[model samples]
Target: MFALLCQLASAFVGAVIPVFYSYKTIKKPSQKSLSYWSKYWTVFGSFLAVDAVLSTLFINYFIPFYEFGKLIFLIWAVCPQTAGAQFVFDKMLAPFIHRHERKMDLYVERMLDSVFTNGPTLALMVN
Candidate 1:
């Protein structure tokens, strides 16, 4: 019961509120709104990735208060007063991404080139 409630709260905070604010941001473009949502989505994506990997690896293990903790974190992240997402992105993610962005871009370009060049061949092989 508690876990289910936590899930509901998390979804509302993490998804519903952002979506509402995102629509508002789209309607009225501003530097502040744009910056906040960008940071929110970046942090949200990072959280999802980490959660997915950890849950997959520890499927059987029980983590006490995980859902509640997640909800609290989401609240903190989305709350404008705290601006946790912005802080996290600026302090952590940005530097790491900046350091390896070139390498990542090169890999992505190579992958895309391969896909475009070998697309027909790959399709034929699949069939």
Candidate 2:
């Protein structure tokens, strides 16, 4: 079925390729490879966050062939010829993140502080 095929494609394009490429980059570091993968990860992470929220809200149900569309996007993101992830990061995500960088950092720091400070208490409460 289309859904199964899409899932397989998604796994390959989204996860397998990235993991392999990341390993290669780690093994042999170069400025070009580091820069490209950094941009790729930034864009990919943004996509995953947005996709999670949309899927949680069932927005995919309204869009026809959402899986196919997602597959195409994943391919575009990772495909060397297009360099879509870098394009997207430079054009969209970078600006947005830069603008909110201070606030986001503050929030993350606060959250981590809370977790570390209250971890034992929280764990006890959970049980």
Backbone clash tally (model 1): 0
- Model 2 per-residue lDDT tens digits across residues 1-127: 8867997999899889998999999999999999999998888888889999999999878998898999999999998899999899889988998999999999999999999999999899999
Off by over 4 Å in 2: none
Model 2 accuracy (lDDT, Cα):
0.91
Off by over 4 Å in 1: 110-127
| Candidate 1, 1-127: lDDT as tens digits | 8988998999999989999999999999899999999989999999888888877988325888888888999999999999999998999999988999999899999999999999989899999
TM-score against native, each model: 0.82, 0.92
Alpha-carbon deviation at 115 in model 1, angstroms: 6.2
Best candidate, TM-score: 2
- Give all candidates' CA lDDT scores: 0.91, 0.91
